[model samples]
Target: MTLPEQGPLRLLALSPFGAPFDADEPEEVHVALANGEWHGNHLHPDSADDPVNALAIIADAVQETVTACLRQVWPVCAEHGLGMHPRDANGRLSWWCAGERLRRGPAHIRAAVGALDTLMPPRRPNRRSRRAR
Candidate 1:
């Protein structure tokens, strides 16, 4: 299946409460890979109501997609070359890098959800800072 441009899959399962999975705003989501092939269950049917829940669900699915199909970590820490995980930064889901750039800072957010491509370019790390773009 081809990955959509919007986000993740939209299987649209009920939340066991009869609420609409998409409510009033239906959208298409892509099946992304670690490199960005996503498939299977989407973030969740009810995440539309709560952004935090949606972000968490999306991050989990993205991680699963990256790990299961690519056999490699997605949104890796370019500086440390280590796999990154998802964490809720405020209300948005951000990639959490486990590597520390210095003492007392072993973890940090790499980028917001779906923004890794912007943060990480096709070249050296020096050219991929969030402030650079």
Candidate 2:
């Protein structure tokens, strides 16, 4: 999608969430490499006004772009080996994993959306961590 104005979308490119990809114009921005191509619409102006909302929007858009353009899930859960989805976790947008019912714990968050590269070993969700408010 074409954004009437550019905002902090460049921030995504600087994080582990996205890498610098070529755009037709310097004013335009796109997410990570997908088959050497970038996809998805530009972030809306209002979402950029708030960090949390912006992250949620970015995570979803990135996932859509990657899945469609690259034909692959953007980030996969290490423990469950399933593709993760973004959900609000205590005001933070996080990657929620649908863990195995038997061996692994129930559905749990893997990590904050942009923190994949810096993730430590997956930890079981305790009552306290699960009930973030």
Candidate 3:
């Protein structure tokens, strides 16, 4: 949290949702780093008036900080090495990739964000029938 403030990005201290500020959740929304040190953007202090809007805005802010300061493409498609982006798939914020394949076609999804570490290993085919034929 020691990081200096980024002036233009900061929003005012949030009141509560529906009380001149957010109304969705009780916890104060903040833009935090992986280490929990937040420097810029306060979630607009009003986005919590609507859950959907708040979620969208917060997601964008988090993604920006992680990708911009980390110097690495976040939530990347490990298989294809392509950068991932936020997309609403199946009513969830999913990490989407554009890796193309012959059978699978284009724009593949790597996995849900924060769940990429659990990707299943690639399956291998059996070669039993080719024995000395």
Say which candidate scores most in TM-score: 2
TM-scores for all candidates? 0.57, 0.62, 0.52
Instruction: Write one digit per residue (lDDT tens) for candidate 3, span 9-123.
Output: 2323445542565555554556656455443455676787976566667667766665566554555576777777767777665678877565576896666644554674543
lDDT of each: 0.61, 0.65, 0.58
lDDT of 1 by residue, 17-81 (tens): 33456556544453464244555465544677997777677777766775677566665788788
Model 2, clash count?
A: 1
TM-score of candidate 2 against the unseen true structure: 0.62
Models, CA RMSD each: 9.6, 13.6, 12.4
Rank candidates, TM-score, best first. 2, 1, 3
Give the Cα error of residue 23 in candidate 3, in Å. 16
Better by TM-score, candidate 2 or 1: 2
TM-score-best of 2 and 3: 2
Specify the poorest-scoring 10-residue window by lDDT in model 2.
1-10
